[model samples]
Target: MDLVTFQNTILPIKDKLFRFALRIVGNPMEAEDVVQEVFIKMWNNRYNMAEIKNHEAWCMSVTRNLSIDKVRSKFRRETGIPEGTDWRDEGLSPHKSAELTDAVSRVRQLMETLPESQRRVMELRDIEEMSYQEIADLLELTMEQVKVYLHRARKTIRQQLIQSESYGLQ
Candidate 1:
């Protein structure tokens, strides 16, 4: 595809891809590298892109694969720990901001505890707002599997959040 077409089609989804990569790789710098690599791959193979339907799904699939590959290559035995959360918000009181930050951090911790598949499914469905069919196509899982993982992930996070609230996890 031409630069204009590429810009119109591919550029819009870069943030989504970067977020997915960050969720998997857990480092902002590494995530940026992953997105750049994805862009390079896409640009290099632009001629063949037309043969693939659903560019977003295809890009997501590539981003997931690449992120996983990066994690595995760099840390075979280490699980990724998410970093670089922006804990700033305007207009909130300090107490409120700290409370919100703590809650978000707790949820991020809960997400980290999930099984990789469940976490990925949750991020794709909830964070990226992808459809079940699209997630299935990208992850090469059945629709049922994606739904089950997402359900389990959400349930686990919700239950954990409730339990933490009960215990006062601040």
Candidate 2:
């Protein structure tokens, strides 16, 4: 593809790619770096762009791999879990809303405890709203495999949420 066409086509997808990377890496700055790297790689391989059947999928796959690599590298360098700023203190809420929000927060925390593969599947399927085939293609897994992993992840999350609600974690 020509530079103009490539720019137009790929530029529109940058935000989606960034969002996917952000969720995978759980860091906005790292996600931005991943997106930039993806576009740079794409630009470098512009001559072979036509050979790629699905450029968007290709870009996403690259971004996902790079984000996973970054996560692994960061984990190795860090001794404990990474800390991020919480924004929940900004809002005022009724008792019911507060309780529900707290439950949701707890669920998110529990989600963080899941395995990376399961968490990625859950994030792509649930949070990013990606289709099964899309997720499978992106993650290089079979559709059946994606479904199985996603089912297991959801089941684990549901069980944790139920336990937390019933026991009321202090």
Candidate 3:
């Protein structure tokens, strides 16, 4: 594609890519770096872009892989920063209610406790509002598999909420 086409099509997805990276890496700065790297990769591979189908899904898959790779590298090096930092608070500011903030934090914690596959699926399907076919394309899973994972992820989250309500976090 030409530069104009690339800008019009590719640049629009940067926010989505950043969000996906942030979801995986749990750090906004690192996610921004990942998105930059993804754009660089796309630019470098621009000549071959025409051969690929579903450019958005391809970009998302690349973002997912790059973000996971970054997380793995950080893990190997032992970054002391703990997970589950509330990255959302800065955006909410003083507008959103404290109860909503706490609930979001709790749900984020619950999401962290899930298996990686389930967490990724939940983030893509629910948080990103992606369709099953799009998710399957991005994750390289079958449509049925994507559905199953999303179902299980939601079920697990629901069960956890029920448990938390009934017994509290003893």
List the candidates ranked by TM-score, beginning with the highest. Answer: 3, 1, 2
Measured with C-alpha atoms, the lDDT of residue 2 in candidate 2 is 80
TM values, all candidates: 0.82, 0.76, 0.85
lDDT of 2 by residue, 74-109 (tens): 898885335765433333366755566665777778
C-alpha lDDT values of all predictions: 0.84, 0.83, 0.86
| lDDT minimum window of 10 residues, candidate 2 | 85-94
Q: Report the C-alpha lDDT of model 3 over 73-161, residue by residue, as the tens digit.
A: 99999973576566765545475746575667788789989988888999988879999988888888999989898899999999999
Candidate 1 lDDT at 23 equals: 75
Residue lDDT tens for model 1, 53-157: 878877888888899999998787565444555422433588877777666867777888999899989988887888999889888999999999999999999
The best-first sequence of candidates by lDDT reads 3, 1, 2
- Clash totals for all models, in order? 0, 0, 0
| Between candidates 2 and 3, the TM-score winner | 3
RMSD of each: 4.5, 4.8, 2.6
